[model samples]
Each structure stands twice: as structure tokens, then as C-alpha cells.
Target: MNQQAISDLITKMADDELVLGHRNSEWTGLGPVMEEDIAFSSMAQDQIGHALALYRIQEEHMGGPDPDAFAFLRPAAEFKCCHLVEMPIGSYDFSLMRHFLFDHAEAVRYESLLQSEFAPLQQLARKLKGELKYHTLHADAWILQLGRAGGESYERMQAALDTCFPLACGIFEPGEADQALINDNIYPGEKVLYERWLDNIYRVLVKASLNMPDPAAITPAYGGRYGQHTPHLQPLLEEMGAVLRLDPAARW
Candidate 1:
């Protein structure tokens, strides 16, 4: 297996979890209700934990930077997370739709990673798979309820889905390292993962009575894989790394 390809894949996954985890943390004390606040907070912790785990693998096994340095010190252009994760949490509707879309992709990606030739990733994927089950459960329940609940709830959810679908597709943006990873069985590739994600998400949307947009007709929001990002990412990174930057050498 190519170490650079493995590093690329791990860092991208870690960056995605870290960014989205920060966004999810924004919901703490601001959710529609206490239950949701707790749920988002819990999931945020899970995402951050996942990020930390992957970063450690990079550091230990791949001779990359340490977890804290890799996560807290990277510039916006250096991050490999897709544009889908960098968008603001926005409204409850938008956040919920993003959660529904992103987590399903994660579920499929991690499921494929379970068969990875890399043992550490395989182990981590196994643990994360269980946590993601709950995350998807929460996302699916809310989507179904609000999607069919009538009135503004239904309208809001549908709108959010339409807006998020294209951005969500960006999660599968092809990367230079992909063919190598696929060839070595390090991963099944993002294209395959995207297809599985579509199937998984389609089932939930069907249950919610939601419309499936024509994926081919929609232009996927891309470029993040090669370090391109929306304007929202820089501010988020500043906020996430603020305290750590005050004194990088200080032990927390």
C-alpha cells in the first residue's frame, strides 16, 4: 500500500469529522429542545473522537504530524474535508438534512473500511460503525417526522433537502489517491461509497415521503479534496483552534 495514499485518505476522513464535529458542537445549548441539544453534543463528541483516532493513526503509523498539531494547526487550504462539511450549520432544517446526508455517507465509507488492508483502520471502523448507527437513527427519525408532519415543517425539510443534495454529493469528489487505495483494497473508493450512500439515503427518504432530486441534473459542489473551500471554513478553523494557538507549546 502507498503510504501517501493512506495518509491522504486518513487525513481527509479526520478533517471531515473534525470540521463537522465543530459545527455540531455549535448546536449545544442552541438546539430546538434539550433532547436535541444533548444529542448533537453527544454526536459532536463522537465525531471529534473519531477524528482524533484517525489523526493518531497518521502520526503513529504514517510518520505524520501529531493529532493535535495536525488538527488544530492546519490552514483552511490544507484541509481535505469536502465542501459539504464546511457549510454553516444554518437552520435546524439545513443541519438536519446535512446530518442525514453526511452520516449515511460516513456509514457506508466506514463499512467499506471494515475490510481495509490496514488493520488499525479496520478496528476503528468497527467501533465507529456502532456509534454511527445511533447518529443515523436520530437523523432518520427527525427527517421522517418533519418531512411528513405537514405545514411549515414539511416545506422546510423538503427545501433543505433540495439545497443540501448537491453539496452532499461533493462528499464523493474523486481524489488523486483514490485509484491507488482501491487497487490495494485499502478502501472500496468514494465512487462506490457514494452509490451505497445513495441507496441508504434513498430508503430513508422514501420512508419520509420525500422527493428524490435527479442527481445527474444537479451540479455537485466540489474542489475541497484539492484544498479548495468556501469562505465559511476559515472562520470556523479560527474558532476551533483559537485556544490552542494562544500557546501551542503549553500543555492543556
Candidate 2:
């Protein structure tokens, strides 16, 4: 893929991290368990950090002026985050499901990108790859707990799985230039990455004794790679963008 295409993908992934980090950060003091509260909050901060790094790279490459300008000022429809990351955090179970789904997605994405032909992206990806391991451990622990909680917790987890499974599958949504990226070795083949993601996630879910999410015939509900987003994204943008939108040139 060309530099523009790589930058575009980077922007999309950065937006995904930023918005989801904001949502997870909302749980800072509200987790059902104190340990979970701290862990979730810390993970949120890490994601936001990664998002900022990618945003800086993107701003320099794509001539976006700066990272803070576009990230905090763009309208909701302009964000490049999939519906999987934009959904409201309904409950602890829902939050756990979201982490389980998206963390594995991140693992696969960063693993592939670590070997990217694009020099800058590869360097950044190599640095970020280590973070995904920690995220996977966190997701796995929570998933196991929820699965074996064996009461209201188990019931809630099942419900969350049903609600978020479709959205979760959409994390692997193919971009317009995905094939080009594969051909150019900017990323691995889509089939390989998708299979790896599915296998890794399913193994964790299976260990948690959860049934498969029946994703055999799933399709994407939203396509943020093409700038499509959920209605909730608007309000989220309003909150995150309020300061920057008002000031226009304020530095972060």
C-alpha cells in the first residue's frame, strides 16, 4: 500500500483505540470489583496512549496539522471506528465481552503490522505489540471469571455475548484497500489474519466454557473504515470534541 493508504489505516485504528479507551475510562470508579476497576482504568489509559502515538504519526503523514486537532475536533461521522468499539458499556459483563473481542483483534492486527513493509508503521507496530499480550491476559482472566461466576453473572455474560457477538465479528471488517495492502505486503493476507484472530479468540472463549457466538454467517453492522458509525458516536464525539471544537487551535 502507498503511504496515504497506510496512514488512512493508521487513522482508523487510532480512532478505534481513542474512542474505546474513552468508553472504558468511564468505568474508572464504577467497576463491580475493585481489582477490575483498576485494571480496566489502566488498560484504558494504555489504549489512549497508543492512540495518541498513532495520531501523531498520522498527522505528520497526512497533513492533519496535529493529532489533537483531528482527534478531538472531528464530528462523529468523521471518526474511523467500527461499531464494535462505539457501543455503550452496558454492564461489567458487556465490558468484559468487549475487551475479550477487541483485545484479540488488536493482537492479530499488531502482530501482522509488526512485519509490515512500511518502515514507519512497522516500527510503531513492533513497539505496540508487547501491549497486546497484557491486554490478552486481562481479557482471558475476566472471561474465565464471568463464565464460571455461575449465577446472575453467568446469565449476564451469556446475554452480553449474544448482544455483542455480531459487533465483535465486525472488527475484522475489510477496508477498501485491504487487498492492496496485502499485495504490497503492508499487511498479511486478510484470510490469514482473520483465521488467526478467530482461532485465538475462540480458544479463549472455549476455555471459559462459552459456546461459540455463531459467527459462521455474520456480516458487518457498521463500516467505520468507510466513515460509517452508530448514532451513539455523535454524542461521544460531542463530549470528547467539545473543548477542541470550541477552541479550534488549542494544543493538547
Candidate 3:
């Protein structure tokens, strides 16, 4: 097996979860409703927990850095999360759209990982499948309700979807190690996952009366996977690492 390829793949997944987990946490006390607040909080916890697990796989099996340090100490340029997850949690509509898109992508990715040749990843995928099921359910339900509301709610959701679609596509930016991962049976590769993700999300979008932008016409926002990111990521990294920087020995 190509350990470097496997480690890079794991790092990308872990970084995505860690960054988005904190973004989701921003809604903890600020959700428009108590239920939403609680829901986001719970999902945030799940994402972070998932990140820790992936990081542990790297540390224990791949000879990677400490989970805490790797997650909190990495510079923005070293993080491998896609740009979609790096963007701020904008309005409720935007955030909801993003969550819908992102969770579904995650669902497909993990489902594919169920067949990974890597035993550790396959086991982790099995455990996370149940959690991701509920996450997608939550996102799907809200997207359907808001999309069918037939007023400002529906309009806003459509607009959010339009804006988020391109960003969501970034979730599948091809990795340098994709061919290696596929050859080794560690993953199915991003292109395959992207198609599956599109088919999966399209069903819900149709039911919601949402029009998905032509992916062929949209240029995905890439570069994050290659250590390049928007201006937003550095600030987020600083904020995320503030506590750790203040006390490097701090334990959560």
C-alpha cells in the first residue's frame, strides 16, 4: 500500500471535518430556533469527534503528528479542507444549503469507504455511517420544507442553492494521490464520488423544486486541497487555534 497516499487522503478528510465542525459550532447558541440550535450543536460535536477519530487513525497507524497539534497547530496552508467548508456560515438559508450539500457529499464518501482496503478506515466508516444517516436526514428534511414553502423561504432557498452549488462542487476537487488511492483500493477516487454525490443530491433537489446549476458550466472553487485557500481560512485557523496557542498543554 502507498502509505503516503493513504495518509494524505486521511488528512484531507480529517481537515474537512475539523474545520467544518468549528464552523457548525458557530451556530450553537444562535440558531433561529432552539431545535436548530441544538441540532447544529450536536452535529458540530459529531463532526469534531469524527475528525479526532480520523486523526487518531493517522497518528496510531500512519505515524502522523499528535491529533491535537495536527488539528490546532497546522497553518492555513497546510490544511487540506476544501474551500466550501472554509467559507463562513452565512445566513440560515446559505448555511442550510451548505449543510445539505456537504452532509450528502460526506454520506457518499463514507459509504464508498465501506469497501476501503484499509481496515481501519473501513471500520471507521461502518461506525460513522449511522451518524451520517441522521445528519443527511436533518439536512434533507429542512431543505425540502424550506424549498416547498413557496414564498420568501422558497426563493431564499433557491438562491442559496444557486450560490452554494459551485462551492459544493469544490468538495470533490481531485487529490494528487487519487490514482494511487484507487489502485490500492483505499478509495474509489474523487471523480467517481462526485458523480455519486450529484446523483444523490439531485433526487432531493428535484423533489424540492430546486434547479441544480449545470455542473459542466460551473468552475469548482478549488486549491484548498493543494494548500491554497481563500483569505478567510487564515483568520479561521487563528481563531480555531487561539486557545491552543495560549496554552499548548491545554487538553479538551
TM-score for all models, in order of appearance: 0.98, 0.94, 0.98
Ranking by TM-score: 1, 3, 2
Maximum-lDDT candidate? 3
Tens-place lDDT digits, model 2, residues 129-217: 77889999989898888788788877887888778888876666777777788889988755677789889978877877777666666
Q: Model 3, 27: alpha-carbon shift in Å?
A: 0.6
The 10 consecutive residues of candidate 3 with the worst lDDT sum are 243-252
Cα lDDT of model 1 by residue, 42-116, tens digit: 999999999999999988888888789889988999999999899999999999999999999898999998999
Give lDDT: candidate 2, residue 29: 97
What is the full ranking by lDDT, best candidate first?
3, 1, 2
Across 170-222, the per-residue lDDT of candidate 3 in tens digits comes to 88999888999999999899999999999999999999988889999999998
Q: Where does candidate 3 stray beyond 4 Å?
A: 250-252
Model 2 CA lDDT for position 88? 89
In order, what lDDT does every prediction score? 0.92, 0.82, 0.93
TM-score, cand. 1 vs. native: 0.98
Q: What is the lDDT of candidate 1?
A: 0.92
